[model samples]
Target chain A: MPLPRRLVLTAALAFPALARARDTIPPEARPVPARLLPVPGTVSPELQRLIAAPYPVGWNVTPTDAAGWRQVQVASSAAIEPHMAALAASLRVRVEPSSIAGVPVFIVTPETLPAANRDRLLLHLHGGGYVLYPGLVGVGEAMLMASHGGFSCVSVDYRMPPDHPFPAALNDAIAVWRALTAERDPRRMAIFGSSAGGGLTLATLLRARQDDLPFPAAIAPGTPWCDLTDAGDSLRANAYVDNVLVAPTGWLGGAARLYAAERDLADPLISPIFGDFTGFPPAILTSGTRDLLLSDTVRAHRKLRRAGVTAALQVFEGQSHAQFISPGVPETAEAFGEIAGFLGRHLA
Target chain B: MPLPRRLVLTAALAFPALARARDTIPPEARPVPARLLPVPGTVSPELQRLIAAPYPVGWNVTPTDAAGWRQVQVASSAAIEPHMAALAASLRVRVEPSSIAGVPVFIVTPETLPAANRDRLLLHLHGGGYVLYPGLVGVGEAMLMASHGGFSCVSVDYRMPPDHPFPAALNDAIAVWRALTAERDPRRMAIFGSSAGGGLTLATLLRARQDDLPFPAAIAPGTPWCDLTDAGDSLRANAYVDNVLVAPTGWLGGAARLYAAERDLADPLISPIFGDFTGFPPAILTSGTRDLLLSDTVRAHRKLRRAGVTAALQVFEGQSHAQFISPGVPETAEAFGEIAGFLGRHLA
Candidate 1:
């Protein structure tokens, strides 16, 4: 079945949720020729290779329930489990399984912490479209930040659906945040993540405001899935052009539905793009030309700036949905560098 | 002939300037299927209709010389000329032919100017790939701004290539800006345009700085063709996806070549993306998800922000190059509204 238009106006509309008419799509939506793309010379050789590479394994799986999601999660976790030790050793970071406020987490500490960031701490949220990555497999981004940005990190292992949906993940995030803020100075802390993790980063802030919690010094939300209602221009414009998340209809659409469950997709908690960003701390957003969530990140940046918060946005040459985090791509290093630089300037 | 890779590293390198190997194109480039695109529900009915409409007349023309370009320019100018009076009358703006510093211009004034902007003025530069819109026909955007933004505007009818090239347009822009500042406060002035006009807006600022002139309070450079070298990622990534400009191999590449003539493409004056943006005034940029110049506009906003200048970027849903300027589209009004609001806050 084709992906249905998800932005329903009301509950009583009885819109055809599963029906997609042939003439409904925009006529301008046509195939893009690869040769017509920016030549290989535009981006670094490493990114060029990655851009030309095939999509990651199992990018199109549409798991139905918790059992099915767990099965896919285990396979993905095991695939990265072997490389975790080597990756940590190379970065000279120590990763220990831990828990914060009873929420499972990973404590990542660099071997030689720079004096400048000694009092600073980063709360990391791993992104897997709110599902895929679990346990140690999700600590890669945290490890990268610890190693490259010279900061101690806590990687949030938030709960996901089809068992724990909506507020469960948000609940775990706020719980950890509350615990961290109670112990550490909010002025010396920051939060960062990519994709679903990025979405949670913003939602956490919205929740923090409601709880009257002091906000962190800054944030880095890279290509956030902040609008889960699938209401951004790139959701349609970048469909197949974005090789990684080739189309919203694939796994992503299923994941959003599975995760949101019965909750309103436009609820600010589920989609932070709809949340008020007033008085939010300085933010640095990252995305690529071909990312499926480019519009989400751009909208979040605009919202932050509109609310009078200082915000910076960096868009890499030609990347698709978190491709900046690809193993050793130069774009990955640059993306992290820009985020770290922004956070460093804001953190006390 | 196909658009050659325009970003040549050096003049002495004996590269195959005219040859393009079929294998050189990325294998991923294939014809996009319209059915897989975002459904028609994403944008306004007016914009959807425009998006669904066929490309504008003469969109694919590639004139060879001065005479050829002149013929094309006349046809385009004549086509738009018939509507100028009606558009101005409906917009409630008076258009008067005038000259500043001996350079031809169209002075646009809203009949009911808001008291706040009585002394403020906007310098307009119209876009036509640097060779299309000329004379009174180029004042459409100025009229829109005068009527909608409630500000007096001076639309620079700058000279274009095939007759005048390189610094001629930039020269005229700076001359008018200097003349305007001589009599009025620079703090109350803003400059704007789309496409080539957008490019000229940035270039004008760079030139003004060199002449040790006071800067305007703000600027709106929408979908600027800021990089004549064709160095941006969108020039390739948005190739066929951008319906209006289709591909870099089209008339745009030819126009860039004709305008730049013998100058270095990467010279900061020619490509403001390479210019320093330090101390630049607040700027609000506009582009669409599918604009061929989206990357250029994105890059300029980053540059301005990095230099500590406030910048806002609005990427409309499903817009192509300058489609935000399409008459009667809600997106166009929104795009102009964002720019006008941003400028209003900054201007004295």
Candidate 2:
């Protein structure tokens, strides 16, 4: 195998020849920048450390501490809130200062107020594999909620894993709910998230039931990681084809492990896939075919239906994971429209 | 377990409310029909008998050949000249006629195309569950191919199944290659199909590899029934979520069995996922998340990528089988555009 110098030369020659034959612009010839600059935001020291840490690989280095994890979690969250705030400002929406059960919160409301507004609320959870939190990701959706569905949105900056593993984020989510229900009408609120946030949204519902809290009117989990066990066929099926995230063993599965370190991967409270969904609020699930978590969404929908809860599942063909976050893409707009319409029908 | 009166009344009230909530405006509310009406075409007596026969609950039966199952071996083919006559009248472009082992072939190029004009051919195979020759469905995709890709296409009215089961469609696809190579080139073709045709698009590539024909530039097997053995998880996963075609033992799986008959379900030729794809072309596969064959598309992409073929799988976020054929939906346009871009990169 090592002695094929002529063959190697032939292969090298073929690369350019093939490119010419295909008439493709070489990567170097493309005009766009090779790197996407990180959005401007204040980086908290804890967040800086978390982001700088090499993502865990294989099944080692399981850090289990709620306090340590919370520092990284909050710092990372604090770093990105300004970008989200900036995006909200660009959308001309005002972010109202608020507190949910003593947890500092921001409510994004549209510039043009609609009178006689029904008390519909969209509680959004940002996704970062349960480790990183990018608050800027949901501006488009939040704006869509305000303008299209006529609902105010409260995005939770929940605690993260490792330091806040297992039930910490779930507890924070519930705390927000406990506080929101004290003032907002329970029948008019909805929970929504993408990726880990999506998982948290489902887990929140399970926790709400266990804690005897008021249930939101509806829930929309977009490409949720409902099963932390990596039991979904897509985990094996879509390992490489999905390009948005790192490989599973290093990224998604790693994050899930850190998030569920002390908890059983199949625990309903941690994963939600194993939860009893009998009395859960109506749900609207969205995912794409190419999404690695497509099976999670599908299985969750099936579980909800089997449990006799009304669930609507909408899949976008040829889409990657969290495609709904791609602001200008038609699928994103269409997905948001569908979510708003669904929330309007159920919560309003 | 006779229902109590109170339970029955409760159920009665719940049923109508559920039905009303589930029911969107009927297809009639829209200008176009929800399902494509079969275009009127001349049918042979044998085909008429087959069409008139009741389809079994779990079987996909079509009026193709009256003869029982038999292996079809292709020895030669006749050329069908590019019919400029039809193109002029229909605002289509007639590609030159060529032959695969002397099988006459023609390509119908679309006019007033959508976006790109280079390096993409929606290599459509007409459906009759591998039994009937391509007809109405061929025309359907042709219209879409022309309007969507803004490129030329060739519809392989491949030979049917049972009388010409496994290899005939494959042979026709090869003939399409022979024809294209004889006239144009192989670097600008993308295979596409629906139902049985979708299965053939997949199966054809498996055959193309065996025959050493140039692989298609790319492939889009829409709602393909790749698991002829009915082994995919979606057979049960999408049983009720899918509305257009019945599931599990319905039209798709039944057609697969009838066409495949006693063939090994894992035979890669019958089910491309089983085939070794060392040299297959890049592909863009599509399916509705709700389609029973959604897993088929997922499995194919996974396998293709595992074998190192570049693949982009697109699942329409929320749709039934072959939703792209519906036309005018933003999803259809998006899917077609992605396929075009993929083809352009690979085929150009």
User: Could you say which candidate leads in lDDT?
Assistant: 1
Q: Evaluated with DockQ, which candidate comes out highest?
A: 1
Q: Write the per-residue lDDT of candidate 1 for residues A102-197, one digit (tens) a residue.
A: 999999999999999999999998788787677777788888788777899999888887678888888998999999999999999999888888
lDDT of 2 by residue, A86-114 (tens): 55665567776666786655687878766
Fraction of the real A/B interface contacts present in each candidate?
0.13, 0.01
| Residue A131 lDDT, candidate 1, scale 0-100 | 72
Q: Summing lDDT over every window of 10 consecutive residues in candidate 2 chain B, give the lowest-scoring window.
A: B71-80
Chain A alone, TM-score per model: 0.88, 0.74
In model 1, how large is the Cα lDDT of residue A272? 93
Candidate 1 docks at the CAPRI level of incorrect
DockQ of each: 0.15, 0.02
The true-versus-predicted C-alpha distance at residue B54 of model 1, in Å, is: 2.6
lDDT of 1 at B285: 86
Listed in order, each prediction's TM-score against the native is 0.81, 0.47
Tens-digit lDDT track for model 1 on B1-348?
121223111100011111111125353543334433432455778677555544444455677777877777776665566667877887799999999999999999999999899999999998888887789878888888887788899999999898998889999999999999999999999999988888899999999999999999999998888988877777776766676676777777888888889888888888898899999999888887778888898778767766878777677667777777765666666667667788899999
Off by over 4 Å in 2: A1-86, A113-117, A134-144, B1-348
For all candidates, what are the clash counts?
9, 28
